[model samples]
Each structure stands twice: as structure tokens, then as C-alpha cells.
Target: MKVKGYPMLASLLAVMLLVGLQTPAYGENATTRATWIWQTDLIKDGGEELLHFASDEGITLIYLQIDRQLPPEIYEAFIKRAHENQIAVHALGGDPRWALTEHREDMLGLADWVLNYNGKVSTGARFDGIHLDIEPYVLAQWEDETDEVISTWEQNLIMFLNQASGSDLELGIDIPFWFDRYTLGNGTSLNEWLIGTFDQVTVMAYRNQVESENGILDLTRDELELANRLGKQILIGVNTKEMPREPHTTFYGYGKESLNAKMEHLSSALGSYASFAGIAIHDIRNWQNMSSDVTVPPDEEEPTTPPPDPDPDPNPEPGEGDRVPDADPITRDPVVRGTYIWEAHEVIRNSQEILDFAKEKNLNWLYVRLDLEQPYTKYSSFVKQAAAAGIEVHALGGHPIWALEENRPRMMRLVNYVKNYNRAVEGDERFHGIHLDIEPYVLPAWRENSQQVISEWTANLDAFVTELKKDSNLEASMDMAVWLDKYKVTGQDMSLSKWMINRMDHVSLMAFRDKAEGSNGIIAVAKEEIAFADELGKPIKISVEIKASHEGDHITFYEEGAAYMEEELAKLPELLKDSPSFTGSLVHAYAYWKNAKP
Candidate 1:
């Protein structure tokens, strides 16, 4: 936040850093903390002054979004038992499909469910990573109609913040304290693609009901004086719960002990001329998950003579003209087609028998898993009430601390607890994309503790889908299936066609498994896994498995194996005609259209 020249962004800032992707081995611990978001839903609706402004006062980073999603061998032993009790896990990348409720691939499927669950809890450790709570560029009021799609997606979000830029994995951008009334800060393209790619931004600052015990809590000081006059690094946002706005028009939020005395009185009145780099509690909010008693110490010091490293040696390699650049033109957009049901939890809580079997069968996508070791807020409120009855969400759940493999600071605080699982509603402003049903595995008694958590979950799911396809306000993917050769015949050392081949646009391949018994024949195994995901050249999206486990008594799909898997799944136009590595097909469920709309 010390903006005098905002860290002197030397020359196009190393071509704005991040180009190819995959960073985050996580080690740094410089420590100047303060990133909390413990959603104590206003101390059970704002009572004990939001629990004495949260456990006796002075809060530090606590952010929580855990609804459900956990199975990578129980979230890698659940974030190494919460960093041996230090409590630093913050992932909350959401999906209520913002942009005033359009489909825009459900904001790129909620930036592919927060970059493959922030690449499976930043597979390693030494925590403190992401917090991008999907704020759909401000649901389109002005951000200049998406500022030329955010200046052509700020060169792939500076190559996904140069592979999610980091020291000990750090990146934040929960934005939307409404650009603090635009004093140039709002010329817009999502506020110059988030003040030109984030290293810090957290906002949603606070909304409506304006205050009460600490009632209408404040602190949007114009997006913290425009990220402290553009040195860009600030975190404010409010709302510990009671949302309302118009009808009941609530907003009177506070109570994690009144937003921790409103973030230590806005970091003691904006820490010494705005270097106050932390607060972000608008969500991960719910009061019961308390524990703050009082901490807020780090008053921003280290300047004894520090700040020198303009290019000091912290792994600064690239000089020989930094080669490996080209290939990211794929920019994730296989346009996410339909019908997906990895672990169909009681068929979406039987929402009218899965919307009368997806309107009688012409199914149109419904990939739901919603996990993080179960009891997920009633399946996250039944996939946000099945997207108000149209249906599209995809999550498939994970995180018992991502099977704690990389071990580095407990996998970067479990990649900020799965990137702050759906921060109440900016990206989830409701559903479409937020799926990374990531299914990594290896055997022979867990291959070397699952190869540093499966190569840190394949380089953190391709740097969380190249950092939410360069978050011009997120779009997403990564729902691979058909057990890619049974994860290489169970030895489980998969690169996944060179790690998500050309890094996602959309990918689906559950080519009817369990060794196609009496025949799920699987259209010649979905044309040999869509020609091995089109020989891994990338641009993928190939599906097939339209009817499984039927004959009642809990799944056996009888009627002659559901009529020969519906006549070999209607022979898929003679098994994908001239397969250009096809880009669609997803069934094996609303129970194979119970008789009409797909």
C-alpha cells in the first residue's frame, strides 16, 4: 500500500511477470500478517458485539470457506492438522455467476473452481496463498462494460500473475468495495485488470445498512484510498453475515467481535500513511468458527534498511531473454458443454427427482460433488438452490488439507483453505463454472507419499487454470474423468497428458469404467478417450457415459444394461465421426434423462 511509485514497477514489470505458469513450492515467511475473514455470521446475528469484535479483539488472517470438497486422501491429512494449530488457511474463490447474473460460463465456471482448488491446497505447505472471492467485475454498472474484456484479459492476467507469483505463495483480490466512487480509479477494465494484476486487493469493503453496536460498520475508505493511492495492496471489505439489502434491506453486519474492532480501527487509522495491508473479512464469515482472543501485532516494520531487492536474488532467473513463452493462446473456453455427475450426491438432493430427470432427459450439465470432507452446508444449499432451477454448477469436493504432501508450511495454509470457498456471493452471485473435480492418485501403498502430493497436484492444477484464466473476472474448467488409463494402471504417476495437456478450456472424460462389464461398450471407449485427449495437443472437451447404475435397488442399470447403454449411447454419430478430438458429451445421469430434456 505505500504507493509512491508502487514498488517502482521496473520496465513493463518483467513483461508483467508470470508467463508460462506453475510456481509455488512455497518457503518464504517474511511475516507482516493480518488477512482474517472468519464469517461468524455476525456473532449469531450480531449479539455480543460480534463476540467482542472477535475473540477479545486484534484479529489476524483466519479466512474460511469450507462448505465441502475433500477426498485427495482426506485433504492431504487435512492441511497438516491446520498448520500444527497456527490456523492459516484462506481459499474462498466463489461462484454465484456475477456479471448481473449471466452465464459467461458461470464466470468461467467460477474460475474453474478457484484454480483447481488453488491447485489442491498448494500441495506442499508453509501456508498463506490465495483469497480471490469472485466479484464479477462489479456486476456491470460501469467498469466500462468489462473494459474491453479487461484490456484483452491483461495478457492472460500477466501470465496468471506470473504463475501465481510468490515467496511463500501470496496473492489476494476479493475486490468490489465498488471502486470507491471512481476518481480515475474507475476508468475501468475491471479497474485496470485489478490495478494491474494482484499481489493484494481484497475489497467488497461493506454494503447497505451502513451500523449498530459497531452496527453499520464502515472502512471502504474509497477502496482503502484506492489501494493506498495505487501502490496497490490493501484489504478492507465487510459483512460478517446478515445480507438483505432491499426487501428486509439488512446490512447491519459486524460481530467477529465487531469486525475485530473494525480491523483494528482500520489498522490504527490506515497504518502510517497506508502501508496497512490487511483486513478482508466480508466472508468465509459465519460466527461460530471464532478463535481470535487477540493477536494483531505486526505493525509493519522490517524497514531497518530492507526494501532493496529490486532484482536481488530470490530465484530471479529469466535474464537470458526468458524463452518458454508462446502456447497460452488456448485461453480456456471449450465453452463447457453439459450433463456431468462425478459423484452425484443423492442426485442433487433429489431436487424434484433431479428436475424431473433433467426435464425428461435432454440433459445440460449438472456436475456436482460439493465436498471438503462432507457435511457441506446442505450441499452448499443444494448447489445454490439448483441455480434457481436451471442447473449447471460443478464442484465434486476436496480438502482434508490436500493430503498434506508438499509439506511446505502445511501446503500454504491449505491454499488459503481452498481459496476461500465461495465468499458468500460475488462470483457465485450464483452458478456455472467452479469445477476442478481433481482426482489424483498413486498406489503401491501411496507412491512416495503420493509424489509430493502428486507433483503438487500437477503443478497446482496448472497454476489454478492459469490463475482463473487471467481473472478478467474469472471463467473456469478441469473435470477430467475416465480414469486416464486408470491413472496409468494404478501405479499413479500421471502427468495427465503432460499435465492438463494444453492447460484446460474444458475437459471431461469418464469414459464408462468398471471395465465395461456387460457393455457400457462406451462408444469404443469414447473413441479411445477422445483420441487420447487429441494426442494432448490441448483444446479438449470430450464426454460419453450417458446412463449408468439404473435397475433400482441403488444402481445396476438393468433393462438390459439400460438398453445396451442406450444402444451404445446412440452410437455417438458412429463413434465421433471424424474426431477432431471432439468437444462434447456428458451423461451417465439426471439418471440418463428419466425420459426427456438434455
Candidate 2:
């Protein structure tokens, strides 16, 4: 993962020192006034309005949130316009989970997405850099599992740094003013390390005052000094949004005029430091909405008025005094009826017929096999048509050999093919995800050396999921046998079933039994998996076989009419009503189910 042209820290520092005497040239080079655009969707219709505002405010840089769901053309148009206004746009994205090793793919995905996007776009529309705003301390685990969270946070950051290396895009991160208080295992301050590590560091000073005990200047002094020594650019950030708990932390009541004056004073105080790039407003929305009345004095210790309704937090890190309001819990779909389709070549030919069947069966999801050799246009029309009928199409392909390290290229071919296909197409036409059906146990290696095969399988799958997620928002899922709960992973404490459930966004458990209940029926077989998935807050899709099976009569629903199968499946929702992870069911396939007995 070593980037070919990545500069050494010392060499980068030397280059920075050579240019340190002059004002840091970012965008227009007029003391680096910047702001954040958290609601990037605004540009979909209001790009010109935003640019005009930026022009009037003399803003030089913008940290725009990355919304992959938004069309690339929206970004292209907005960024192109911003460039004309002399504003630099950096892609901004991150989450608390991104700090964990399990979610490293999500972090790296953002970087890869930007890199790929920049390559496809014109120079004027390309992003200037990537800015991560990951704050792991917000998670409850930070209170109880501090060491583990810290370890993973450091590891993920290193991985991100390595992934971003050799790229032309500048890499930056947002750190709280108090990061200097946290020390790494090596005893170096976290803020000091970050300042030296990244191209730029933006310290969230978030105080109305420029000076005072714990004011903006007081809080950012240590970071600014460290950045000066490391020869790194540092932007001091201030909040304009109302904070009910910490009234002094924001310029909400002070108005734009007061905030402007405070920023000017802050610039004067920190301007002497070579690394002091400029001031960054917390966000554009709040800054724009900030009252022009200047209700509170700039030197006031507290807000003169009660806080208004809280705005969405763009940099939420709840600490002792800075407590962010909890967001509403997310609810899952009541049921996700699904099926599998193996013959992908027929998709374009029989697009309407497939949609008709899917709608008739009320199937919301389909695992459609992907023929890599087939052109992307073959599936585009079918996928788009299926989407119109409220059905998601996931590209499916797998082989037993894909479980081996040597066969990774084969595995990645499917991933790359799907990724490139999605990039070429528009919304709904792209595959919703990749559904893997690799069953390594079928291979001779399984019996020859079970442990070694299991080890390779685990490594291969981990790489597959990681690579699949690195550039796209595709859901990584796989089919797991109901009995995998019995086999433990090579060295892990958990079973292979639990490992897969934890890793995949959702797993389709091949319970295969015709009956819904009984000692050895579908419900009983999937009980452990459903419970494990619920514990992880992931989903489980119980799959029943419709195709005739040579294995056993008990395994297939082919003997039973579609009416009888529906009768048994109807009991699942009521039986597993308490289990949130039971996201309905899937038939083994479309071919047999289509011609099954009524």
C-alpha cells in the first residue's frame, strides 16, 4: 500500500519551511477565509446563490460534504462555478464508526470515491482535497472501551493516510482544540502528531471570543504552535450555530458583524505563526442565518437571549460541556421479500416478464447473477425496469475457488465489473449491491485441510468486502449456510456464521427447510443466526429452496404448492415478531418458483 511518490515527513516539512515566510497560498491567497457546506444538496438547485454568497463574503475555501447519491454532474457544475469565484472545494465526509477498524472500508471508500471522481471530472470541477471529520469520542464505547477505540482510531487513520498517499489531493482532518490533552502510547500529543501528519489541520476552536480562559485563541494555541513547528497549514474554526448547553461556544447571538470582528481579531493574534492558514466558519447555513442585529456584545460571557432550535451538527463530538442532541433511532423495513435469479443473460430480453413476476410475488429484492462478459447495457434496462417496480437488483456471482488467496483476482473481477458498471450508469439502473454465493466447503481443500481452507476463506472474504466497499456504496453480502454457526473461525472466538453476520450488511441464511416451525425446521435452524444478527443490529434474510433438491424432500418447497409455501411463510412474521433482524424471506430462485405448482 506504499504510495510510489509519497513525500517523507521531513522532506515535506523542509518544503513547507521554504515557503513558510510568505502567506499560505490557498485559493485566492487573501488570508484563507473559508467555510463548510454541510448540506451539499443545496447545490442541486442553489449553486449560484451559494457562489454569490461566497463571493460577497470573500470566502476562499469550502469544505463540501460528499453525497455519493447526488449525481456527479451536480458537483461538477457547482465546483466549476465555485472555481470561477476563486473558491477551493474539498470533499468532506466521515463518521464516528469510521474510526474503528471494522469500518476502515467506509473511510477508505471516501478517499477512493474522491480519487475516482476527480479523475473523471474536468480540472475546474475536481475537488481540491479530502477532509475527514471523524470523532470517535462520541461513541458510548469511548467511555468504557477507551483503549480499544483509541487503538482502532489510530489504526484506521494510518490506513487512510496510506491509501491517500501519492494522490494529488491534499489530505486534512478536523481535531478538537483539546486533542493536545490526549497522548499516544509513545507519549506524543495527538494534536502534535496530527499536525505533522496531515497536509492541513483544522482545529475546532468553537468559541465566540478570540481571547479569554479557554477562548478560541487559548484553545487553539497549542495546535497552531505545533503546526508552525511541523510547517503545516492550520485553519482555526468557529461556530455560529446556537449551543444551548455551552452558550459561550457559538456566535449565534453575536451576529455576523460580531463574528467577523472576532475572526479578524483571532487572525491578528495568530497571524504571526507561519502555519496559521486562516479562519474557517463552522458552516454556511448558520453563518448566513446569523442575525445582523448583533444582540450580544463580542466580549459577553453568555448569550443575551435564549437559544433557538438547534441546527444539524456537522462536527458532532459530545464531550463534558459540548453535548450534542441524540438523533432519532432508525427503523428497519417490516419485511423485505426477495428472490434469486441465476440466468442474467435473459434480463434484457425478458425485462418486462421479470418485473411482472417480481411485482406479482411482491419481491422487493433480487439477487441477479452477473455475467461479467456481458455488456453493462444488457443489465441496465432490466435493472432500471425492476427498480420502477420497487425491486432492488443485486449483482450475484461466486465460485468455490474465490475463497482462496490465489483466486482473489477472480473475486475482484466481479467487484470491479459491478463497480465500473454502476459508475457508467445512472440511479436505479446500477446494481444495488453484490451478493456472493461462494461455498468453500464444497471444495476438496475443505476436507484436505479444514483449518487452512477456513483461514484462506476468511482472509479472502475480508479482502473482498473491503475492496468492494473502497469506492462505492454497494452493500457487501453473502449466502451463509444455517449450520455455519457450528464451525468456529480459525482463531476467532465467534462462529463463522457470527463472523459473516457481523461483517456483511445483511446475510441470506439458507435455512432451506419447507416448514416454518418445528425442531429442525426453517425457524429453528435460523434462530441462532437471527439472534446474532439482532445483537449486531444487522439484518438476516431467511432463504427457502423452491428448486427441486436431490439432497432431501424436507429441504425443498417444490413438493408443496406455492399456496402451501405461502401458508407456512405467513407464520414467520408472527412467530419471529420480536426479532428485529428477521427481514422477511427469500425463495432459493426465480426459475423454479416461476413454474412451481399453484
Question: If scored against the real structure, what TM-score would every candidate get?
Answer: 0.32, 0.49
Task: Please provide, for model 1 over 122-178, each residue's C-alpha lDDT reduced to its tens digit, 9 standing for 90 to 100.
Answer: 454333565555543433332335544443333333444444443344556566654
**What lDDT does the true structure give each of the candidates?**
0.43, 0.77
Query: What value of lDDT does candidate 2 attain over all alpha carbons?
Result: 0.77
lDDT of 2 by residue, 1-598 (tens): 1212444544554454455435453322437888899888789984898889899998999999999888899999999999988999999998999878889998899988998999998899899999999988766566557778877887787777777666778788999998877777666777877776677888998877677666777788778777766667899888886442245567755567888888777777775776788888988987887767555555534332222212312222213332113322226765888888877655856777888888898889999887676788888888888888888889887765567776678689899999999999988799989998876664445556768988888898899899989989999999987777666789865677777887788899988888999877888878877877766677788889877665678888888868899989899999888988888788877867887767
What is the clash tally of candidate 1?
117
- Deviating ranges (above 4 Å) for candidate 1: 1-42, 45-53, 60-233, 236-273, 281-361, 371-395, 399-436, 439-572, 576-584, 587-598
| Residue pairs in collision within model 2 | none
In model 2, the Cα lDDT at residue 116 comes to 91
